[model samples]
Target: MPSSAGPSIDKITEGGRVTQVGEGQDADESAPPVMTFGAPVAGEILAERYELVEHINNDSAGRLVWRGVDVVLRRPVAVVMRYPGGDSATEMLQAAVAASRVVHPNLVGVYDAIDEAERAYVVREWVDGRSLRELVADGPLDAGRATAVGNAVASALAAVHATGMVHGNVHPGTVMISDDGRVVLADARTDGADSQENDVRAVGGILYHALTGHWPHAEAPLHGATAGHGRAAIPDAVRDANGAAAAPRQVRAGVPAYLDDLTMDLLDDSVAPPSSDVLAAELARLDVPADDDYLDSNGPLRFAAEPGEEPSPLAAAGGRKVAFGIAGLLAVALIGLIIGISTLGGESDDPKTDPVAAPSQSPSASSAPAAPAVRDLKISAARIIDPDSRNRSEVRDAEKVFDGNRDEGWSTETYPTSNFGDFKRGMGVWIDLGEERTIKSVQVNLSAPGASAELLTGTVTGQSNESGDKRVLDEFKKNRIGQPFEEHDGTTMTFNGFDADQKYRYLLFWITELPSNGNGYKVGVQEMTVQGS
Candidate 1:
């Protein structure tokens, strides 16, 4: 082959077998045959073009996969290689060339295939993510996510089957979930192991595993097909005494009847499987729009703060501007009383000259503290924010943090595991004070101890939570108050040392890290108090 960058003959690891670039199957000496030739060292250039970066995974057929970079193109690729002089090597190269001809967004793109006398290799696109096997290992996916994944796989199969070819391999290991939430089917080993019907059946199996967290094809040879302890595991399809799989809805509560029927029909040997295109269309119908199913938490309120700091005043007035007008009327009435009192006091002893002098000093007196007593400032509105933009939940209950009730507070849904389920950066509750006001300090209480959080403040320019708090940090130029509290267990988050009379409108109480709640992770704010009258 002509050299794209350099021409070298270094063996690559198992290529497209695993969805992610660098993950390998569990180490098992009894596993299927792997490459007999020694593994390639890091930095070794293969075909003088693809430089070996890291070893990924060994395929079930025993090919070594590698993560490498195309020196000429400067793009990442996966290299699957085997030792020279075998029917398997020839089949691998031929399969790569064949797959390369079929281009689809859902299918992994093959770049090059070469078979030297010494070794055979196939270079393909690298997906920077985990396989479906890894994703389902944690637990079952939600209905919407499961449907979306199934639709992607079915669509990919529809294209491949249309070209008069077979994917041959459609197991979880061949399905990839990109880091950016894209779903792609990869690693087609069309060595005639299975027919197009088998691929269609596999899509049903994917949906089954996602909906139930149990691979109904437990007896199959696919990696991650069965759980440990010799148990079949929890699945929507229950195995009968004779090992027959039951309908999905029969085993799971939320599985819709139509989805349950489709899943079982595909798996049933007696029933003929639908064509890939037909199946793809059906799955598409079953799939709910992710946005519609998972509504984002409400965003921050846009209007300026209502005039009064009393709790729920904005809620009662039904409109922010109207409430602000009411508060303004109250403020004017209070000013009139103060002026009457000051005038009455000034008339004492020397009425004329002192009153004029007092009026002149009033501007200087504006610098003095307005109020001595600390009050609970009402939070008119709030929204939930995920810095990674992945965890957009909890908007409806966000105002509970300021509901003046410790018993009822706001909380994020429990993630699969702490660290935002390993998929999100962080989550926060952005509180809107209706309008800017002097902030003395804020007290925050959490449901549990040991979670980490920070007090962030920003000024609202136009509307709050309009863009889902995307510009909040930019608005305030990242104004952070107080050191981040890492050991917080429902303690008050006091935001002191703020300019005494400087008005601050928007505040964000962000949770950077969450403490373990035993069943995955959940963090809640029991109460939030803003003290400034």
Candidate 2:
């Protein structure tokens, strides 16, 4: 609760809940539920003065989740940044803190950074809710929620761009939602080749998914190529994907025609229209049918242009609303398709620069802009919460425990069960990382062996996964990990990088020897935790 200084937990218990002393934690209606990850992070404390709740991730890059404590304040909240135990964690934390200065409401807050004894951590105001990824699967989000998600994230991007930062990872997975359906932006640390335009393209991609209930990986072009020297060039792939939408109106019916037009317009150019702040202004002012309540709740925050520019776009747009849901809509896919694996390679702990997705040749006509453009959304940033960028050295586990009940615990909904689990065990949960990072080691403690499956491990590189001009990373994980959940029977395994460029976020911990598979021992995982790169 200190402005320049943060606090530490006196006696935070494992999986316990803690309250924050601030407006964000005012009431149940106000605070989103706390999500945590298990395992005692700090030393042996009796009752977690701090509580941790776990949430499921739908991105290719694997991220561990948690909430921390104010030992001095005796409160608890969310922290978003790579766990500092892994290699490159230091550099990653530095980048995360640099970007954390980016403040906006629709965006989640970046509280403080704590680094102790050479370990690091990043904390923020926890949304205490779900994500857009979750809402899409629950059923098409009501139009209000959808628009809120779009408009809010746009506002967040505007702030990010205002500070010259970019949210490189912009999938449905990065947006966080509240219990009552408030939207917050997650992963403020997207770096390297991250840019304002990519963030815009991601917004378009998000809008497309919200409306259609389909997860779209825009086969976006990086200035025309994914090879050397071209990745920095903004890609029109998102626009191409938006344009490729079979029926914009048909997919979600009520989307204002103009909104669809805007999304499509975003995709058309290889580069983003302008800085996110500018684009945000455009979002604020663009004309829409009157009486749409979603946009009204989003207040007009100041757009940061000096003296004066043209009228704000967001003001004209009438403040649209967008809902937050974290469980991805298409986790359980009946129709399968392979996606290009992440080209950012090397599992070494060192912060080797992420291989920028090379810009493509013969760039789209729209991307040939004279300069870097920022959007004119003009929407003011929402107030999530934040602090100084101090990297913390501990991780708090999710307060909610996995009970093996498919509906309640873990992200069964996000990752899906029945078809996804291969159905051999009682319930199975797995994550597929899109990029490869050095995994120092992993430990799986089963809650109960009865339903546990064998945790399998393997490696896949970008070069190995690439096929001609395209790469199918999803296919590499599913076929390589999904199909053979049964092959990995026993215990621990160590695997290395799969590419000069890594292909996926994480290696699947598949279950091959389920009790149903006749061993009768059952597959149980009390905890599946990975430590450091």
Candidate 3:
């Protein structure tokens, strides 16, 4: 359950009836007739598999949120149930089914969606963290942290949009951060009432909220904001008398100019929001370094010209054939001038002893190739490499290492000793850069100091499936790249030992030892980034 600092509400469960008691409201007066009429009790088992443990709270739409357990899997799950199902529950069920189709690390996993005529409920991965709404209740996030949150949201949106669908509900409440530092976007509303463009715009809203500690979209009420409930908890954006919300920079100090511009552009009705993928890429580009001071020279994001739209003057000029023709003429004239000078000077028979110099080499005629530009490479996919584990459940949250937020990450299970309780030799996180890319450097940020890790690389082969993952893991363990980073005692590790001449596709950050965690030993990767062409 999300940790809240708000006013407490007393919940009473009697004779299978649930009543919510708030300040200044009597239990009899606050309890609606719906509470006693077939409402699910705390211990009631639904569909004979899900057993409700605790009723968390009721949403604005009167839906109940319960901390439940999947009896068969024995895993915690969040069960969202709405009463009098049938037609009223179609949208929720449909959204769950649609959300379940696309699987991404940032998006919440939809385990099961069931409608039992009288009631409908969605069983989802239970997150043991707070929402963005709760996180910002005290104040705003720093610029870098805000950017990271926005990046995670945009990445999730990109994945959702890739499947030709929209996550209609995208706000602080829907963005969940787990205890282990995983940022996940949850509770997507695929009601068709929102457009894909709107979904992208909502990411900007998320950024605004994160940076300014206020919800920007006052026109559209927040998803869980009720009349006297969650709405007041989230304050509206600070606006001028002219009815314009202040930019993030205006609201807070030290915000990067590029970030402020991107946030405002997303919220601006005049400017078209970039597609989710583009936005995610831009955010990932900005989410660098392990600190909050984002003073990078990477300027504001620029979107490509829309089809049928006029290009900028510089852009148009660069693409014109006349430009190239003029450059060619200039090159020819320069060469001719050089030749004429040489002829007028009466060149000697021996070129080495000539009084006049031969035609000077043009700048473009240089024999040396230009250096490849180093950049932050985009990771297409990532997963945990725990071949020794029986169930491989530890691989589920591997995406957190690359999710942009340095505060959130993936951790190995705690062991009695740093050597994994002497059960396994090691475990790691493997990342795929989509295709082969020039090798440069890889940075890994850990939760604590003194944990030992290594950087290894291997060629990509086999189909991108379960068998393929197994094969890749086997190959990586057998064929080590360079040498392992041994006796590492720092929280941050940078592997710049990559060969400049080599191209790498698959790389592994293998953890051989865990830092002490008081009672036991565990290690967590807060963030990981790769830099290459």
Candidate 4:
């Protein structure tokens, strides 16, 4: 029998109800003992708070899903647990912690994370819904509904992208639709296996699956995505042997030509995917209007006008009456003000000094110091100073760092551990500021929080040099400027000291330490501003 305080997960036998053979029977009633289970059995309250009610499904990565309850709050929750907890579980818990930072209507809410050494689990909102995989299991959905689903997922990704984090995983299994018609994206992995561009491409797969009842990417970790082949066989654009995935229109009817182009463009590696916010807005525009005229995108509000209702009295009179009333009031006030001004003019006093006399100009005013021109000294060139050839390709492209756009800056690849993977010395961006000038300050903006770097200026005109040959700015060595990056407050690095005004043509902004971003060690320099003359 199910308990009133907590729901029962045990099955009923022919003879009677079935449960753990021995539960409270062997316990001493004086004190509640720390209940332990050999396995994740039902009725087990983990951390003495969450009670596991029923087992859901296990993910491809061996994370166990369970429908649990928060005993303190008396509310249902979903628990994703992994046993023999170590690095993998630690990564999962970290991912959960990072995901918890963002709150959105289309994102699954993370409640808490628990690591018991032996096992680690993430507690999240219990969504009463079905995964996108399950929804498209029988057949493809209608075109309009498919676009709506894509729009919601894209909006969620936009939020995640705004935070400088990627949703690494965005397959059918992670997309969920509630019984009450809510669409949400869930379970962001912090492993950094996929990039933001990959997340955009996954949306294309979702569109293809909804139109043809087949998974487009067979290698994707989505449940039931691959049956035999490496990737789910997609029709249409698969040229003789080039492995080009086909457009949706070629595989199924009713798929609009424009929609087909958009879908294929995402799947095509040659073409770059649009930003998540751009894609979301586009999908929203393409979504069909709801059946009711007054409902609009969302349902009607209490004071909203009905479709065929008569105009209200104020609206029928239009804005003319209100305008005339204000004008009349203004006329009365203007008349009284004109009379007062005339009376003051009649009683005017004698002038104290010449009204048109101008202030004397100083002799230095003739050569008025030319306003100090402040312009961004364009970077003559930039190159990655990676001593280790192994991590050469892993370095972010140098061109983006000086592009002047924060959204497209360079980023380092994910390291095995936080401190430069423990072996590598570090990586730096060697830049030429065209010609030497008084460098007043060097400002840097990073993507994630805690990163430590030094503004290095060297006389070496060569493109690259080893760390030993490079000279750190005197202020940094003196512990004046180039302080450690802040945890959450200040990301700006201003190297303004007595020595900062010196002129230097070659400058190296080197990162010596990486910040813990819940994931592994990764840092991105999005914007760099050099204020000098």
**What TM-score fits each model?**
0.49, 0.41, 0.52, 0.46
RMSD to native for every prediction? 14.4, 31.2, 17.9, 26.1
- Listed per model in order, the count of residue pairs whose N, CA or C atoms clash below 3 Å is 17, 145, 1, 3
> TM-score for model 3?
0.52
Which of candidates 2 and 4 is the stronger one according to TM-score? 4
lDDT of each: 0.67, 0.41, 0.72, 0.63
Instruction: Give the CA lDDT, 0 to 100, for residue 129 in model 4.
Output: 56
TM-score of 4: 0.46
lDDT of 4 by residue, 416-473 (tens): 4555765666677767788977666777888876777766666654423334323333
Model 4 residue 97 CA deviation (Å) reads 0.5
Ten consecutive residues with minimal summed lDDT in candidate 3? 5-14
Off by over 4 Å in 2: 1-62, 80-87, 116-119, 218-243, 270-272, 286-533
Candidate 2, residue 470: Cα displacement in angstroms equals 52
Residue-pair clash count for candidate 1: 17
- Residues 505-532 of candidate 1 have per-residue lDDT tens digits of 8888888777777645677887788878
Worst 10 residues of 2 by lDDT: 384-393
- Residue 349, model 1, lDDT: 52
Instruction: Pick the winner on lDDT between candidates 1 and 2.
Output: 1
| Cand. 1 Cα-lDDT | 0.67
Candidate 3 root-mean-square deviation in Å: 17.9
- Model 4 residue 89 CA deviation (Å) reads 0.4
* True lDDT of residue 412, candidate 3: 71
